[model samples]
Target chain A: MKAPRRGLAALAPFLWLGVFFAFPFLLVAKLSLSDTALAMPPYAPQIDWSKGLAGLAAFVRALDFETYARLVSDRLYISAYLSSLRFAAIGTGILLIVGYPIAYGMARCPPAARRALVMAVILPFWTSFLIRIYAWIAILKPEGLLNAALRALGLPALDILDTDVAVYVGLVYAYLPFMVLPLYAVLERQDHSLLEAAADLGCGPTEAFWRVTFPLSLPGVGAGALLCFIPMVGEFVIPDLLGGSKTLMLGKTIWTEFFANRDWPAASAVAIVLLATLVIPIVLYQRQQARILEAGR
Target chain B: MKRGPSFFNLASVVLGLAFLYLPIVLPVIYSFNASRLVTVWGGFSTRWYAALFQDEQMLDAVGVTLRVGFVSATLATLLGTFAAVALTRSGRFPGRTLFSGMIYAPLVMPEVILGLSLLLLFVAFGLPRGVWTVTVAHATMTLCYAAVVVQARLVGFDRTLEEAALDLGRTPLQAFLEVTLPNIAPAVAAAWMLAFTLSLDDLVIASFTSGPGSTTLPMRIYSQVRLGVSPEINAVSTLLIGLVATGVIAAYLVQQRRRATA
Candidate 1:
């Protein structure tokens, strides 16, 4: 009952996050409601601090949903939002297909090799992500290494860079470890006896895997998918670097609106909508993670 | 019924690794190219490295990045350790749900949203967007990661050691400093490094939060990369890759050795 010191300890983090983390969203929301203006901060509805309360009332009255209205009316915003979702879905699927076998192989490795294999998967992740994505630019560019190698082998040059195909390739390459690590965690801990039981009962390797191993790895698959999909939806670097100017992803859309157009209100509106779209899945993922932690405890 | 890996599994592992590593290896290899053209390798040389070191703007950006990384990582570690301890130790305070939500939300929040929101907040407060602002933003973003790493270690921690120290006539702070600190040192170190790298590698958030004269190395590299690939950028990228790879492998090996000893 008398733990004031502990209470203070708790208050420090709470205060920091409340101010820095949670409060900013309110600012974004407020900015989204305001109109664009040619000003220092590039948003309208400025309060006249000379007449404090009256000024505040006028500012509140100035607020409207005009930016959100524009977002709905604009075809570009709608397509960007849809395109972001489509890219995320396709990227997640590709990552799952490409990552599952590698994770399975890593999980099934001899105990001595498993740690090293996990490190191999994680090593690229720890390296600079921007550099890795930039690396793809080097490989996929016209007349780059891929084409150079193709020409050496007497094959026609592949023009994959600056295309949607290139974007998917970059996503898969950059986020493969994210997809694999969780899958490996679940698969590595699975009991081998179930597979053996299936084998003894006349299940083939593929059948045993599909029924016993794959079913149990569903949690990991979900985890990995959400991990990759959530970020891919708002990913700017991958698309901007590889997807060319024609790709209309929401993240890039927001950047152009904010930086190039200096329309902070519009950018904030797009960001708010993006958050609204992602809120449910984010909460679900958090709950799942909490459950996993509880189960571990 | 023990069996070696099937051909499907083995082949996938090889191909997957090749896919993951070739992009990175190619850049590092080409960094030493003597030709000005990235595609054509005239011969092997360290001329790009020499050019990279002499570039003042690149050096300035590097200095800014290192300073930002160190400051933000330290701040995040300190605050995040407090957050982690608060989450794990302090049972059921008011606003606990909200506090915990803030911690986890950043991990899932898009960088663009985070960056934009913070920029607006700084603007509202009339704070100049510069190195310190970027540092604050990075700390805010990275604290969640730091808290998670520390919280994982804390969850598995045996509290009895600290309790014993407390029972032996030490104050709570003293017990924490002497017993808990040593026990969680590795996790704290790991968290700091994670935050540092997250700050270092960030481009999107820093782009929004940064101002003129505070361009980070990633932003600098990005501008050049957007224009086109250059040998100097390759040299810088290779250096970053080497530095990070060495640090991570060393940390991982230390962790493995600690696990073995324990």
Candidate 2:
């Protein structure tokens, strides 16, 4: 009796997730097999089981290695993908460089001061994301605050808006909190005795950090990197708003295909490809998280 | 380990904090600027806040957003708490691993992909996309967050209290109410708050599912920002920031007080 009741309870969420979330993913995969012409209102395609196999065959036939081939040769998609990767990579790098020290300082502070400092870091996040991005427009635009200050200082006015630099800046600014919070959490829990032990052995402050503290903080670094990198890879608003019309990235491409072209199949194809690319990093991060949790236990 | 105060650390912290706050601070400052040109700082005034209060579209969007958030957060929290209880306390079932993975997929999946897939599903079902659809979509996504928080709380809990109550001849339901509920109430509250915040913040999924008449506050803000910066947006953002900050602080203080008492 207990077993049955427990089984039913355990099964409840899975059933809900299967019906809602998993089912939609399967639907997308299934729809990807159907012909684009079959994508009309009451959007369910009439599936003949035999014809479904044929439709799958047709979908494979349409695979047009040309898309992937073009993806390689076509400078636009290739460059955009590269640029996005570059932006995410560099942005994550900068966040680490910038966020680590701050998180360390925060960790070293007294508990009350740490909480207040962390709250200050998080205060900006309370505002709408779009509004914060919009605020960046006022600061980064050609005639905006940054440029105005530059002009006043007798420096050349920089047109930072709609540039790759702006994209990097925007991404890093947006995601720094993700980096800081995780790093802070890890560092706060760190055993200060380890550092003292290293110091008693005549190790310098820098050497002590590298030898003892840094190695221990690797998990936090990994966690923070994953948090920053994964979302930045698929970021839409920053690229669209700050990168302007000139910058073409996967997120904007997928958005246009779904909304403007109304090609669900092609859009699904793009999403699948993006997901496939992201899966490796996500899997690695999950494994790391599991290890961390295991260690905590 | 008594290192002198490092200037490098101090300077970096100051710079990093400035970077985080600049955008927020600029908007707040601009909201009071009398000039329409966001780049120029004219004399300060409360005109933008006055204008924001008068904007019918902004008011309507806020109303719709609050309604959707309220419904979705409550539903997601309930479903999430149910799932958390089941998974943490119950026996294993077939496809238990698969079910766990599916529940978490929404949390990590790109919102764009989730939005696209849901939009297609709605179309496939011949369901009209609107406020109700948005609520369902938001609940689906926010449930994962609620589940994760509740699961974290459940991990530290001692289950023997409930078992002891059961052994004392109370029914399972009665034991749960009398023993388990009180212990995990904090987690439930945290889960609800998390779900509420997530539902309030969601834009992409809501964009896909909401109709013309059901535009959410974030959607409205996105459209406004797309054109250019506006003082009214600044006023609205400041208000939202104030509200969320207050809530977070209150929650933190309550948690601290509980910890002290415990």
Candidate 3:
């Protein structure tokens, strides 16, 4: 391609992301630094471009880190952040434990069964995420199906709805496909000869798996864990629908702050902090993707 | 040299699949309940589906969702195709790092952060939040997904086919149209489907960016769910699940056919 054409090709998405993707974060940061006002947009120091550089300077002068300070001082905000991290960490651990075996099973299946099994995992992913989480309510509520089933079986009814356990259930249900697919991809490509060699060396099947297969699948584990963990940290629907009101996830906090509280600056501040926590994972994911793409080439 | 699944492996797979499916299955089963109370099965009936179809608000939300999904998915596919091509084919350009970062970042960015930022941007720009605003937001978010999907196809693409087309005196665009486009059409189509579903599935961003009268299906369902899960919502979920499952199966069959032919 010609230089001008190449430049234009790059420029299209570049300009689009600049305006839509990248610029918005700057606006959020600016909003986060601004003081809340009892005004239309509910924040102050609006840039008056009509007054040119003077207005810009005045706007700059009006900005402060007060919202961040409030976020720090407020136990609610701190707990929300910590709770989000905690849920995500525990959820990731459970998903890994649950997902690894399933993925390993699929990877060991016959080629035909493997394809079918993969589709079984992906079909739910194709379904509406909101609907899937909502579905859990039917099974988890006090007078829900679980209790009905328990009654039929003459067992004690379990009350799990509107609790942390329900949130974990939702988290696990929603993110299991993400965890399984990547692990399966990595596991399916392992060299069978390595296992055969290990067997020849008198290693038990389990021992061979831990020493060979499991080590080989760590990249997939990292990819899957990060994929699930990053989103779970900011997950709104799962927690909102399945979690109790007392649940203090940052995503729900941001929503409540923005929509209910009408604290735009505070919401922006929470969002900024949420983004800050995710920067490392996001960067790591990007690098891993680049490496995968490079290796593909 | 392949070994069959062990008993442990078989058991875990069964239980995991059951866990993954039971929540969805319960709702689908309950959607057919004749009773108003969701827990009670008053025999088989489609009254909820009838109620769902007649509900004007539900129908309106569905209409809005379909329109948003179509428009945003198409826009995302175009921009995302451009992005994938540029990221994979073009060597480098100004602000490439930032550009690539923007492309990949949204894939995992928190929906709350994205939605709030875009809402602030719209507020700053004095643009009214409505269907178009929601559409734009969906396009921006989903384009990254589309890009990643299309990029995977593009990276493994045989560039020499396009090179050969260009060597045959075709213009760059012509070569792309004649050779590269057909090769990547399946991936592009898959990307569009993914983007559409994502747009269709989104609740958080739409909840943030949408104005009055621009409520998407997920938003409508969320509101209803918050009120309480009803038979009508169950019916809606079942229909949506059926629709998506159909699309996925059809695509899989087509892909299988294509692979066989190839």
What TM-score would each prediction reach against the true structure? 0.96, 0.90, 0.97
lDDT digits (tens) for residues B197-252 of candidate 2: 77777777888888889999999998898777777888898887777778888998
lDDT of 1 by residue, B55-114 (tens): 999999999999999999999999999898877766567776777788888997889999
Q: By the lDDT metric, which is better: model 2 or model 3?
A: 3
* Kept native contacts, fraction for each prediction: 0.68, 0.51, 0.78
The superposed Cα distance between candidate 1 and the true structure at residue A13, in angstroms, equals 2.2
What's the CA error at residue B93 for candidate 3, in Å?
A: 2.9
Candidate 3: tens digits of C-alpha lDDT, residues A207-271: 99899999999999999998999989999988888989998899999999999999999999999
User: How would the docking of model 3 be graded?
Assistant: medium
lDDT of 3: 0.91
In angstroms, the error of model 3 at B251 is: 1.8
TM-score of 2: 0.90
Model 1 — TM-score against the truth?
0.96
Top candidate when judged by DockQ against the true structure: 3
Q: Local error of candidate 2 at A42, Å?
A: 11
